[model samples]
Target: MSRKLLNISIPVISVLLGLLAGAVIMLVSGYDPIQGYSAMLSGIFGDEYYLGETVRQITPYILAGLAVAFAFRTGLFNIGVEGQLIVGWIAAVWVGTEFDFPKVIHLPLAVLAGAAAGAFWAFIPGLLKAKYRVHEVIVTIMLNYTALHVTNYLIVNVLSDKQDKTENIAETASLRSVLFENLTDLSRMHWGIIIALICAIFMWFILEKTTTGFELKAVGFNQHASEYAGMSVKRNIILSMVISGAFAGLAGAMEGLGTFGYAAIKGGFTGVGFDGIAVALLGGNAAIGVVLAAALFGGLKNGALNMPLEAGVPNEIVDIVIALIIFFVASSYFIRWIISRLSKKGAK
Candidate 1:
């Protein structure tokens, strides 16, 4: 009972500390923290449109968070989710634009293309790690740049129009839903949120109810022990990366098929992958936790835009708060210590 309570209390305390620290910063800067917070809440929940937009924004974050969390649970660091997402986006766009098929066939094919492209891109690093003992972090980081340039080259030389963006995907290949639009008061929210939720459930099931999951987690906990126990650590590593990249790729599909119906040439990283790390960490790398954490992040990001307009606070202050939250989350040892001390005092 105490363990479960501690698990819950630690994150809650960390969040409160982060918010308190942010309030202090705002006070020091001569801004009203209460007003800023009130505006932020209102912006997030003011109407159906804002709520829908927040959900839409969180759709990708949830998938990306799951990707990172899945890898983390398997004792791997997948920093290349951004690269996988890029390649997946291009692949989805390519399929959506080039294919002529029925809505059912085309949409699924485009989504699959995105997932396969992401898996393939991640496979390279996984293979290198398995065969040559290469560090996945270094390989994935470098691959991010490689994926960016390669996707850009393909867009410029092969897939793009005069405007440096891919042609709009066919409507039949889109995941947008008029019904959802009407329900959300004309926000960009789409059927992709359904897919994201399904993926979260799928991730939870895979991790909690499967023999393969047990082996993967065993390998993660102790590779040597897992190997001695007849588990294949190398195989698990490669498989973990592949699955992680697939989730990230699905996130890319949400952008291509739902948000934009086209792929734009990017100047740099999308930052979604980087944000996934924070999401995974704050969520304790658990599947359900990732969903909740992603929603919070999505709300913050959606609400930040209104801070300056409605509350006379700089939007960048939200970024500072987010950074501080990450800091507090990373310093979880301190929070745990405090909790332990409190528990001991109560027992005494």
Candidate 2:
């Protein structure tokens, strides 16, 4: 019981500490923390439109978080989720624009194309790591720049129509749902949220209820020991990266088919993939945890605009709060020590 409570309490306490630190900063900056927080909360839940926008934002965060979490669980650090996401976005938009199929076929096909593209992109790093002992961190990081340039070039040369953005995807390939729009006061929310939820469930099942999961986890725990135990570390590493990239790709698909319905040439990284690392850490790399963490992050991001407008606080303050939260989460050992001391005092 204590162990279970500890597991839950650590993150909650870390969040509280982060907020407290942010409050201090706000005080020093001559901003009203209470007003800022209140406005932020109201912004997130003020209307159906705001709520729907938060959910829309959460959709991709969930998938991206899952991507990082999955790789972490498999003993791989997949920093290239950003690159994978970009390629996936490009692939989905390409499929959506180039093809004209029935809605039933086109939407799924485009989404799948995104996932396949991400998987293929990750496969290169995976293969290199497996065959040559190359470090995945460096390889994936470099690939992020590669993905950005390659996608930008393709958009300019092949996909775009004399603009920086690709043409709107075919309606048949879109993930937007009129039903959700009606319910949410015409917000950009779409059926992609349903897909995100389903993928979360799928990840949970795959990680917790299967023999393959066990093998993958074993490889993560100790590659040499797993090899001695007859598990193929190389195969698991490749498989883990492919699966991780697929999740990130789905995140990109949510943007391409559901949110934007097109691809835009990016001058820089989308930052979603980088944020995934924080989400996975805060979530403890668990599927359900990732979902909740993503929602929190989504709420913060969605509500940031209102903080400036309603409370006269700079929206960048929210970024500071987020960074503090990550810092606290990273230094969770201090929190654990505090909990242990309090527990001993209570027992005494």
Candidate 3:
């Protein structure tokens, strides 16, 4: 119980520390930190449009967060989410552009293709790690490069438009924001958010309410013991990686089908998959916690884009703040010490 409380308190304390660090940096840079923070808060929450953009920014973060959290629960670190996302994005766009089905059939098919692509991409590392005892961290990292180059080649060669970018997907294949426009007057928010939310819920159910989840957790805790108890540790490891990849793939789909309408030319990933590590840490690998953490990250990311336009602050300031938060969370012993001292005093 105390440990759980500490986990919750750590992020709160990290936020406070990050804000303080940001303020100090602002002061050194000869700007008012208060004004900067105020502007950031306002841009993210001041109006309906801004709020919608916040959610839009959050869409991919949610899925990415889930990807990382899912892997963490299984004692795996899937850094290949970037690769998984790229393949998923490519598969989704391919399906969306090639299919001529009605909305009901087309949309689901495209999304499922994305998921399958991601899962398949992930399975490679899972198999290597489980069967040959290769470290997943190394394999996933290498796969990131593979996914990047492979995706770049496909988009620029086979799928490229006249201008070298892929052609826009058909309207029927796109996830429309018309419903959100009616409510918030900001069309940026789309059905991707709904899908992300559902995925989170589904994962929560699987992790918290299912026997497979228990076996996975057991393996995460002690693979040797789980294997001794007749659980298939190797299979569970592969399954966990595949599931993690699928979530990452969904994130890629959100960025493509939901936002860009098609896969566009890219120098590299936008780092959403990498950012998922921080989100999962901040959320303590909890499903509901992932949603909240993603929202915070999304607000920070979106608001940072406007800070330069409004306050002359570099958007990288947000990255620095995020780094500080993650640093403090990783070194949460300090916060725990302070909390323990405070509690001792209160008890007296």
Candidate 4:
């Protein structure tokens, strides 16, 4: 098969295999796999409310996947999306609640604040990686812990005046749509999905259609050669991380301004940032692919809630299925070999 067809087929096959494996697991665990999957599908698409909720979940997944995919394109491993998103959540809420600007200015400014905060957080690791040869993964991993505590402290000590959450953002900064809510039977869907789609397009344009993109890809392919060709490898590394973090921050903004309309202290990691790694891997790190992967993830996540209710199966099985899918995607090399062997046998 052509590389393009192979790229598409791998993910599709992985997803199918994952579902099959999940069914096997369900059978072993004494649950009706068919009923479980049927309920899952029903929860995701059988009702307008669930469909809207799935789209709402998808919005942030798209941005998070874009963040990881963008970094991968430039040969960067940004493990700090969680931290970047944490700071962005607070930063956006701060601007949203503190400002009295008009809707047009307030909403845009709040969103920009989130993007800027994430960029700044990501910049630290980028700068260190470029100048000191420090590994970004280590630095970003450490920063996630720091961000969690700091944001929690800020929430209790500053933003919320000893509360665990901040106040609701101003009406001007809210991304809520009453019309959409009514249409979906009060689901949390918002226009953030539009923003996520736009950002996906932006990533594609920058990486595939721009001079900067060429330089970034060149650096990713070979930094030493890129530098010899006069492309500043250091600059591209920093730029890539910054852009990736901006997308991550926008993911936080979707939650803060769209779904929750506020920021809250968390007892643990949000998981969305980490899940982005899987989405990017499963999507082959391409913009369109990422969007599709995000939708699948969203559907599974939203639909998982119904598994126990209708099929007497634990919802955690969905997570297992997702993990299986990601595992298969990551093992694409082995799968390719298997396919190649099968094809040769068929030809013989």
Among the numbered candidates, top lDDT falls to 4
Model 3's TM-score against the true structure: 0.97
Q: With candidate 2 superimposed using the best TM-score fit, by how many Å does residue 145's alpha carbon deviate from the native? A: 0.6
Cα displacement (Å) at residue 79, model 3: 0.8
Q: Which stretches of candidate 4 lie over 4 Å from their true place?
A: none
Report the C-alpha lDDT of model 3 over 245-336, residue by residue, as the tens digit: 99999888877788888887678777998999899889889998899899999999988877777787877888899999899988888888
Per residue, candidate 1 scores C-alpha lDDT tens digits across 1-348 of 288887877677777888898889999999999999888887799899888899899999998999999999998999999999999999999999998999989999999999899898889888998889899999999999999999988988889654679899999889989998998899999888888889899888888999988888888899999999999889998998999999999989998899889988789999888898888888889998899889988998899888888889998888888888899888888988887887789889
After TM-score superposition, the amount by which residue 232's alpha carbon in candidate 1 deviates from its true location, in angstroms, is: 1.9
How well is each residue in 227-316 modelled by candidate 2, as lDDT tens digits?
999999999889989999999999999999999999998989999999999999999999999999999999999998799889999989
Give the runs in model 2 whose Cα sits over 4 Å from its true position. none
* Better candidate number, 1 or 3, judged by lDDT: 1
Task: Give the candidates in order of lDDT, highest first.
Answer: 4, 2, 1, 3
What's model 1's lDDT at 142?
98
Residue 80 of model 3 has an lDDT of: 86
As for model 2, its CA RMSD to the true structure in angstroms is 0.9
State the TM-score for model 2.
0.98
Which 10-residue window of candidate 1 scores lowest in summed lDDT?
A: 1-10
